[model samples]
Target: MIALLLALGSSLAYGCADFLGGLGARKAHVLRTVLVAAPASLAVELLLWPVLGASFSPSAAGWGVASGAASAAAFALLYQTLAIGPMNVLSPVAALVSAVLPVTVGLLQGEHLGTAGLLGLPLALVAVVLVSAGHGAGGARPSRTALLLAFGAGAAIALQLVFLHQTPPGSGVAPLIVGRAVSSAVTLTAAALLRRRLGPEKPVYAVSAAAGVLDSVANLLFLLAVRSGDLTVVAVITALYPAGTVLLARGVLAERIHRGQVVGLGTAAVAVSLLALT
Candidate 1:
């Protein structure tokens, strides 16, 4: 129960962070948002390290660096998609893919899905399709490019999740530092290559920084949850982050949902519940 609660909290924190991140990217530059967020996130982990008693392991650091690169690309594409696409449609597709990919990875790692997991998996896939099929007020569909980018982001996210889990024991936040540093470098390079303005207004900086803090917290909780339970379970729970993101978009952005999306949400809820009991 504690693990489940932690996973849920992680999902919410991740959702909130992604919401703020998408907003920041839309208002400023996509790479700039990530550049600012990475160091801020790293700072929080650094602050926590003393009390947490971190260790430095080369293997863990390498794993983190690899994961960082994948995650950087993922976030960049995701933010770009969010900037131009309907949040409700893109988020659920990305979330579903992210969940499914890691579960596949876990299975390859010799973790067998129980009966509930097998039943829930198909339902979640159906939810993903229904949510993606939903159109906004004018029946405008997301561009094919945006959907492709979202799928790429999901694949990258799966790589990040798997690599982060492979971090050596007792490394603590050292791996996080390495990972974020690598990610930051990639984001900065991408920003330069794309000729994006890196400087944002003071107010935007606050939003970006807050996004970082929330992300750091979310990642910590995810790691904790993974440590306490099955990786497949934790990954699915964390991928449910779209739930919070969708709610926030509706409330703050006034995004309208389709009837199919409502049904999709119900299916997602049933799927999550079944998976939880697994």
Candidate 2:
């Protein structure tokens, strides 16, 4: 239950990060947004590193770098999709792909939580899809490109969870630091390759930085959750970040909440409860 709560908190933080990152991307180049976000995220982790007494590990570092690069690509593609697609289409597809992969991986790794957690998995899955559903009551469709990018982002995100959890507990902070550093470099290169430029917008940098920091912190919390709890449950719960994002959009962006979202939220709550009891 503790681990589940931690995962839930991580989801909320990640949702905030995604929202802020998207806001920042609107004002700056995608790569630029990542570059700033990466370092800011690194700094936050570093602050916690000493207190947490996290040691270093080359293997962990390698995983972090790989995960970071994947994340960078995911972010870039997600922003590009957002620029040309609808939220209803992009968000759900991405969230579903991301959650499914890790859940599959967790099962493959011999992790099990009995019937309750098992049942919760499908509910969590449904929640992510429904929560990400757009404004249309019947069937609002988004651009195919948006759907594709969202899937890509979701896949990348799932890979990230797999890699992060595969790291040994008590591994040092080196993995996160290396991941951020490599991500920054890779994102910058991508920006150059794509001919995207950093603009002179302050809000872009500020929001991107905030997003990065929050995401980094959330990642750290996720690692801690895994260290202390069942990876299967943790992954399922953490992957529910779309719930937080949708709520924020409704509250801050005044985005209309559709029936699908309400259903999704209720499903997620039930899943969390079942997972907890199990």
Candidate 3:
């Protein structure tokens, strides 16, 4: 139950962060938005160290670096794919693949789920797809390159989660701190390389910073949840994050919620309830 709650919180935080990051990216280049957000994320993780405590064991450091590198790639690929996208199709594809890969890894590692969990898991995946489905039509179909990028982004995201889960149990938040630090460095390097392409238009700094803070919180929660819970369960629940994003769009941006999303929200609630009861 505790793990379920933590995963839910992580999902909410991630959804909010993505919403803000998307807003910031709209105002400036994706790299420029991340240039602000990545450092801010690292700062938040640093602040958490004193409170949560950390031990940078070699295993933790190695896994942290791996996750961090994967995270940077995921961020770049995901944003670029979305920019070129028919977002509705690509978003769900990425989300589903991210969840599926982690779940597969967990199962291969011999984690088992109960009947309720088995049922709820597929429903949660369906909800992920439905919630991310956009209402509009008539956009250009996604190219083969966009599809490949989306798949790569999803794989990167899954690797990040799996690597974090592989950290030593006693490492606490040390892996997260290390991961954030490495990701920040990578983001800065990418920004530097792309400086010529990144126009002079400034990103919304406040929005980007807020997104970073939330993203850090989300990662922290996910790490904690994975440590305490079955990765298969936690990953699927976290993948339901798009529901929160859709809700925020409705409430904040006054965007229309589609029928698919409404059903998805309901399905997500039911899925969570089933998982909790188990």
Candidate No. with top lDDT: 3
Report the lDDT tens digits of candidate 2 across residue range 1-278: 77888899888999898788777767765566777888898898788777776656777877887877777777667667666667666777788888888878877888877888879888988888888777742365666666777788788888777787877677756667776777778776776776634555544677888999899878887877877787778877887887787788889889888887899899999999999887
Residue 27 miss distance in model 3 (angstroms)? 1.7
Clashes of each: 0, 2, 0
TM-score of every model? 0.84, 0.89, 0.96
Q: Candidate 1 has which clashing residue pairs, if any?
A: none
List CA RMSD, all candidates.
3.0, 2.5, 1.3
Where model 1 places Cα greater than 4 Å from the true spot, the runs are 80-92, 128-148, 194-203
lDDT of 3 by residue, 149-262 (tens): 999989999999999999988898999999998998988888888889999999899999999999999999999999999898899899888877888888999999988889
lDDT at 249, model 2:
85
Query: Please, what are the lDDT tens digits per residue for candidate 1 over residues 144-220?
Result: 99889888878888788878778765778777778888888887778778763555433378889989999988888
Best by TM-score: 3
Candidate 2: global Cα-lDDT?
0.78
Quantify how close model 2 is to the true structure by its C-alpha RMSD in Å: 2.5
Model 1: residue 83 alpha-carbon error in angstroms: 6.1
Q: Report the error of model 1 at residue 115, Å.
A: 2.4
Window of ten residues with lowest summed lDDT in model 1? 131-140
